[model samples]
Target: MSGWSDSGWGLRMQSWGEKYNQSNLGSPDCVSSSDTISRPTLWAEPSPVVPKGADVTLRCQGQRGRNRFQLWKDGELQEERNTSWHLAEFVLREVDDWRDARSYRCRSGQGPLWSELSDPLALVVMTGDFPKPSIAVSPSPSVLAWTTVTIQCQISSQQSSPDYNFALLEAKSLQVLQLQSLSRSQPYFSLPFVRAEDTGSYGCIYYRKTPPYKGSHPSHTVKLTVSGPLPKPTLWAQPGLVVAQGTNITLWCSRPSLASSEEVTYTLLKTGTWQPLRNQNATDLWTDFSLPSVRPEDTGSYRCTYKDRTASGAQSETSEALELMVTGSLPKPSLSALPGQVVEPGKHVTLQCRQPLQPELWRATFILLKVGSLQPLQSQRPVGTSAVFPLLSVRAQDAGNYTCVYKKTFFHQVSEPSDVLEIWVTDASPKPSLSAWPVSEIASGTNVTLLCQGPPWTTRFVLHKEGSMDIIQDEAKFFLTRVTSKHSGRYSCSYQLGTNGSLWTQHSDPLQLTVKVSSNTLLITLSCVIFLLLCFLLLVCFCHQYIPRAADFRGNSFRRFFCCSCLSQDVCLSHHLEDPKEETLYTEVAKERPKESSVPIDKDVTYAHLNIKNLNERQTNPKETSTEATLYATLSLD
Candidate 1:
């Protein structure tokens, strides 16, 4: 009788009791349990779903004794075999026809009344037209050893009518690795902590639960490749990792020179994502992935991996991460210099980059850029709204036009560049020569030229005035037209060299300029001089009235003369004058009490006289002796 079993093998067995009851009712071949040997058990090898043109074997086992086994198919007696042992075997060789996919039963006994038939087994042959299921793998097919992997055997919904049973098998040997039955849910086989032994191609098939016990064709094979430690490839960027907006850049993934395979597939993956950004097949050891006109969205940390087209399909370890930065995405920051942009060579200065105060950019990194530099000079994290880059002991090479930007670390969003700030480092070189044209001191409303001469390489000149905050930058010569008192101060000059005039020399020695009144006031000054000269001549005449003999005057040697006149013999003189050689003296006389009295004199004295003796001896040249007579006088007033 046709029957069904939940066990995947589709076992349909008839018990000895049923056979005995049927014999008592009509059949003579069956007997009671006391008179008949116990029923034997029958089973099939491998499975009932035999591949076309393949062989299948059925085995029957009974109580230990010599036994004769009879095989029945379609209720008809088929081939039978005898065995001296407890088990008998039947082989259906070359199961290649549709008729071979039928149910069969077997029994084993020594006598004519054989034991009851063993369970019926459905031999479901694999028809080429059977529905084929698909296989998929989780994670990746190629993984490091000891990684858990799940292989799923999925069938179409149309195949869901009959309860399905799934078997995962080794593709090479067709050996069953896992078997499971499912009523409605899909089936999957998990190889936990898979090892090297589990690495191979695997396939799966599904069969129905009941008779006609059909099985679908095997699904496509999935290769599970397990590998040991693999050498890591190298990743790098061409033209550097930091680039400007809309700049083309290439990322290279290169395998080791000693790698065994030349045919390789390279994958570039950015961090925080599992999917590859690009894939390339290359015959060479290295492959390039070009990102043209890269934007800020392309900035991230990326790594690359390569798969060798070897027999095992081995995968290399992931390459080291490379960070790419794209500038000019956000609003620009403002740049400034502390302690001024003109710095001394041995001093310290700071460049401050002030970022826009926004909540999204609080954790940005600031970068300092110098003109003509390939890479950023420095980077800093923001403190408050700005980041400060301290340049200590700056030298001439550090001087340049600098700009700044900020980037968000997480997103790699870069900000627009700040305005350029020109920095100058001052050196101890020879100072420039500072000179003024016309004169250092000049009257008001005059044009003045201050020339600063320095080395031939000097590109610019700076003029500074003492006690003034205004700085004048110009060429070597600074011209001041119609200068006023405001321009009268100590001035010094300095020179700078190199591109953008970043290097500066020490300041020159200071110069002072004096501004006086104009020519319009000269007449009043001359008239005042004439008035003083006439008064002096009148006073000398008054003193001549009190003349004394030169001999007597010579006696009063202690007296001081206020006026002295020299006259030649050929010139006219006053009547009080004596011989030219006498050396007359004039004086304002005071009453001396007849040369003995001590009474005070109230009259004012106009002059005092002094004597000269042996004047010839005092003459510097004997041949050039002077014949002129000298007059001495003292003028005083009460």
Candidate 2:
């Protein structure tokens, strides 16, 4: 409006007509042209980044012109203007960002002497991606093996027709794993049937489609983890996780019915590291990894994974973590169900747990537990590792599993649970039984141990010899470190409940611990040799009798009884029972016994007489009787 008026209308019309013809002419259009024309330069305000449906300005500027300007988009006429200053700006409104209607050019004229068209300028529409696109996995970072997952990569720019491409890469290995290109219609990728190897962190990048095709920096990394498919094993720590220094505890890893009878190997793993703590191949129902002694450094989270020969021989999924909160400053003590593990209903049961400790820890606070329960049943600050929890008149409900732990009042540190112990309150805690080993006529001097066995529930025991009740024992086995004749007395044992030692059950049936003199090997050998010599002499005498002596020399009935009795009374009594008059002792003794004595005492008769004598002596003095056989000397003056 401010420039020259239309007073040059005739000239302007002539100029417009001539300029329009020149505008059509280009370097490519002319084979050989006449007049040279100076061209106006064309450019866009913001290069290559025009947004869709946003207004854009294409300007053509040069020396003051005839004020006639025209704009063309991608070889098509857009608009024309008669302008004011030496510059002409053609405003393009509502231009589509991705609609290829972008390339533009302009021409300007000053009557009759018009300039050729300006250079073509291209505009690219973009929203964002000035930096890079961000990619993220849907659902969660952790996914189960063999499941589908979705990863969405998003750039701020939403181009109608995208000219930028995106590439997804694995951040872990820095591998170029393209999920999908941003230039594509869809930017999100679905990972179907994911696997262990698929677990890793990922990132995405965007690049231009134009020449040079520049690429932006990678996006922030996203983590994805895939867990294997397997039944997790059960993990429980014996003597518990929080423990004292030098305390031995076992971590039991169990996969019951699944293991069948085949042996399985179990490995215990700690968090923050791929390495395992220990492993053991177990043939039994469960495998155990023993921490023979734990130190403060051993505290951490623990889990167990195992592999068996059968059903999915591969290692199982890692079990849930069991936090080991070791505190050496805390006190640890042993736990036991005392008097015994089994107690009769209406009997006092004492759970006594103790561990040896220094005198400094005598006042440690103790806590007893019926596992799976949070509250401890017994809490006492005892003097020493020993903690006694007594239940009076225990009922069936009182019977269950129990364990204990200790803590110091000052630091509030706690020890781990002790080994599991069971309290079995049953129908009249049955009396324990007794038995001897070896099942033989025990040789004197050889060590003989009488086992006093009770139920697993019972703990305390007292053993009594038949004659002496004053001697008592706390152990189940009564070992006569050495045995003599005096030890041949009946023994019985009694057990009780409660640490208070207020009550006891009936005594076990008596078991006699017998010792014998027959154990003397040299005496036995000498007796055998003498008997053989006597037999030979008797044979000679008998043969001599056949030559010239009386009938009394050839046969004497008591001979058998006398000769066998010389060995030992126990042997004599045993043989005497088989027959009264017919049983003989030795062959020589049977031949000479009647000749030696005027009384015709058979083997049985002699045994009966000896039994009578022993009975008499026992009744009178309670002392063992000694027997002697009278041997008469037949002296021949020859």
Candidate 3:
């Protein structure tokens, strides 16, 4: 074993690394004390409490030949040492420092195989010289469950720069809930979704960062009381009664439906205070919880609650308490239909729930519940011998298993759930067909008739349209006297087998109705005309870039006449017949006409600069005919 020299040991040392002999080192497992061996104990010498800048010694003692020891403070390992002596000494000088007030322990062993951890011992470093701080709870002390609370720890200090570490402690347990290093005169701790256990006495303490880390005295205690129990949640079970030894039963809980899309968790409970059996998350008002297969031991009261995980924290409110009784002998209550067990699809049907109980339970509440449904079909305390639930125009979907139960309203004492009575309806009739008049595009303001043909036995009909929720009527024909764009949709019709029943035949294939431009005929025509006019304007603009215009032709009439006179060997003239002063003149030039010509254009002419620039530019560059207009009229023999 190796030991370190004394000069190398420093009291300010935080942690020391160690090495061990591989042969003596055991596997990385717990050393069994089953083998006869001595365990080591650790203690701090010269008192556990010391002022800043003082010295302290930590000693580890145990049986001889152990060769190694490890020390931990507050569950964190301080150091490991490999030594020949069974006893090890750790010199910690300048005692008031990091983690000096925490509890510490040590264990000794040869290698990875280690001894049981020793009991924790507290070491207090006297650091009560800093100023005491004040504690404040925001918005009063009492808070509802799942609400946020801010606890502010402030010290009265004019110092612009704070140099202290803040800590909030539970007065009774002395447990530190918040420990932070802040340079603020007032620092707050935010507690969200605070539970019942958070209600207690709390105090704030602070300390400046110096040699021994001097901490202030604890502030005056503040009492916090969480007002309500976790809000109770609505709890119920599916296919209920929670039969013992039964398989696949679901427990459900309901909460006020929120628009928030956050999925929240639901916890199932056996009792008000019992731990949850399972947790499930969903966004709907109902959260279904599944439990393990029921057993004799599983028979108990069950409840549930929803936890809003999207909130500040996963805060929850428990549901109303509900009890479930498990027994092999369930009551056999009589269930029957009113008109008859076997009825057609179009007749009214009624289910009767009858349960036998004590004479005093006549006034108790009775419920008729259809199986697989969480809500009862009917619940009433006024029923005498039985409760009758009228299901108007019973459809195929209204048929299922049903049972009844009597519960004492005052005490909520429930009787055994009755056996399920299965009832079914026959609704297999010939489906009807739909026929829309013309079966093609219909002009606006025209009356159209959609005739739904069904078997002669059918008595009712329903018209449907694609992408719409409105049901047209209960007739074989749907008449649209005034068609419009709104009527342009896929239409179908279904006819009922009987007038009083709800079961109807499958809808016929859709007949698309295309209603042409309805009330906006004039507006449509105007829009088309405007569209054509714009197109014509665009075409004119496109051609105008390359073609000469009438205005330019009229302005150059005189020049054209002069050229015609020079080439035709005759003088020609023209005039606007409507205007007496408007005329075109050409000089007589039948013989030897001048080969060059120029016009004394007025300065008011729009293209004067164009003419002069073209003449000069063409003379300087003859091959470039871009200014070829100058060749048409040469400067007067220049």
Q: Per-prediction count of colliding residue pairs? A: 6, 19, 10
Candidate 1 lDDT by residue in tens digits, 277-328 = 9999887768899999999998888999887665766677899888788878
Model 1 global lDDT (CA atoms, 0 to 1): 0.68
Q: Write candidate 2's Cα lDDT for 452-476 as tens digits.
A: 7876645678877866754556777
Write the number of the candidate with greater TM-score, choosing between 2 and 3. 3
Clashing pairs in 3: 11-93, 231-318, 232-318, 232-319, 233-318, 233-319, 234-319, 346-500, 346-501, 347-501
Q: Ranking under lDDT, best-scoring first? A: 1, 2, 3
Q: Which lDDT values do the candidates have, in the order given?
A: 0.68, 0.60, 0.59
The alpha-carbon deviation from the true structure for residue 397 of candidate 1, after best TM-score superposition, in angstroms, is: 5.4
Model 1 stretches with alpha carbons more than 4 Å out: 1-234, 238-244, 254-256, 259-261, 283-285, 311-317, 340-347, 370-378, 393-401, 409-412, 422-638
TM-score of each: 0.33, 0.26, 0.27
Worst 10 residues of 3 by lDDT: 19-28
Say which candidate scores most in lDDT. 1
Tell me the spans in candidate 2 whose CA falls farther than 4 Å from its real position. Answer: 1-294, 300-328, 331-342, 346-403, 408-439, 442-638
